[model samples]
Target: MAEEIKVIVFGLAHEEYGIEVDKVRTIERMMPITRVPKTLAFIKGVINLRGVVLPVIDLRGRFGLPESDATDSSRIIIVAVNDLEVGFIVDSANDVIDINTDSIELPPEVVGGIKAKYLRGVAKIGGSRLLIMLNLSEVLNKNEIIQLEEQEV
Candidate 1:
């Protein structure tokens, strides 16, 4: 039997992306975010969730995708990486599936306009569907992490 990993799949710009279930904390519906000054463009500021303030990142902006207004289907995915817990605003998060690790392949230079440096790998699911796995560490790189820390409120 092949090693299977559970993935929390979400939509971004009409494409599918997954994050290992272990890295995800929770997924919530779109909520109000208070903007902070001088932070990164993609950093959509912070959100107050159940008494805890979490910095939020707009994944579309983070991936350099076209900006679009949030809709009813928008969601906020909270993930913890490198001792930092942050929220990522995604188009929608509606699937959780188990995938065979063997099905994953090295990422090409670019996938869906996102650079390969921010990806872990690309997985082929059901032989036709592709899932882009994000390297959270690289997505929340050390330098950016420092900046986020400084903006803590």
Candidate 2:
């Protein structure tokens, strides 16, 4: 049998979610951000990391959840989308977990307020634990990001 795909899971507003580890580059603590006016509410702002300006988005806010102040557990999970680097802020990062394809199921008609179209699948962990696997490309599409950038300009 083929090896199960592993993903790095995290929490945002009490919900567990994950993205393929291969898609994730690194995870860092919350850094200073320069807020840009007239952008999407989910976009907290941009951060300069090692000379690279990365746009940071609050996953909770993106999912239409109440915004909260960054805490010690807050982290920015850097991911590569279409060769572009973007940072996503989460409440806390859990750990890397391997899940078999058979263990993954299609997301229900809806997830919280997010449409299932944005999800890749739902991974079942322990008995009652479920992790929503995200479709990185759909979640961070360049066109949408560019649109937000244009709004800032």
Candidate 3:
């Protein structure tokens, strides 16, 4: 039997979420962000990752949560979305969990304000806590992301 694919999961506003570990390039702490005007409210700003500039999105803001200050636990999950490299700021980065295909289940019709189409599935880790598996492509599409980038310009 083939081994299960492990995903690096994180939390945002008390909700659990995960992404394929392979897509994640690296994780970094909160850095100085050059604020860009007229961009979406969810977008914090762009960050200089080494030599490359990557847009950083606040997951809490995107999910319509109350604004909170970044703490030591705050982290940016650098991921490649539709060939565009972007970073997502989350409350905290959790452990890398191994979840087999069998353990994954499709999300319900409604998940807060998030549509089910954006979710890959839901993984029940322990007893009551559920981890939402995210489809990066759906979550961050090329066309829409480009529009957001254009607004920054």
TM per candidate comes to 0.92, 0.90, 0.87
Clashing pairs in 3: none
For 39-149, candidate 2 gives per-residue lDDT tens digits of: 888888999989999989998877778999999999999999788799999999989989887888999978877778779989887879989999888888768768866
Candidate 1: tens digits of C-alpha lDDT, residues 1-153? 679999999999999999999999999999889999977778899999999999999999888899889999999999999998999999999799999999999999999899999999999999899999999999989786577657764
lDDT of 1 at 37: 92
lDDT to native, each model? 0.93, 0.88, 0.84
Candidate 1 — which pairs collide?
Answer: none
- Stronger candidate by lDDT (2 vs 3): 2
The model with the greatest TM-score is 1
TM-score-based ranking: 1, 2, 3
lDDT of 3 by residue, 1-153 (tens): 635888998988778899989899999988998888877878899999999999998877766678688999999999996677889999999889888777789889757567787789988877687889987887677677578668767
RMSD, each candidate, Å? 3.1, 2.2, 2.6
* Candidate 3 segments whose C-alpha is farther than 4 A from its true place: 1-3, 145-153
Residue 12 Cα positional deviation in candidate 2, in Å, after optimal superposition:
0.5
Q: What overall lDDT, based on C-alpha atoms, would model 1 receive against the true structure?
A: 0.93
Better of 1 and 2 by TM-score: 1
**Which candidate number maximizes lDDT?**
1
lDDT value, residue 29 of candidate 2: 93
For all candidates, what are the clash counts? 0, 0, 0
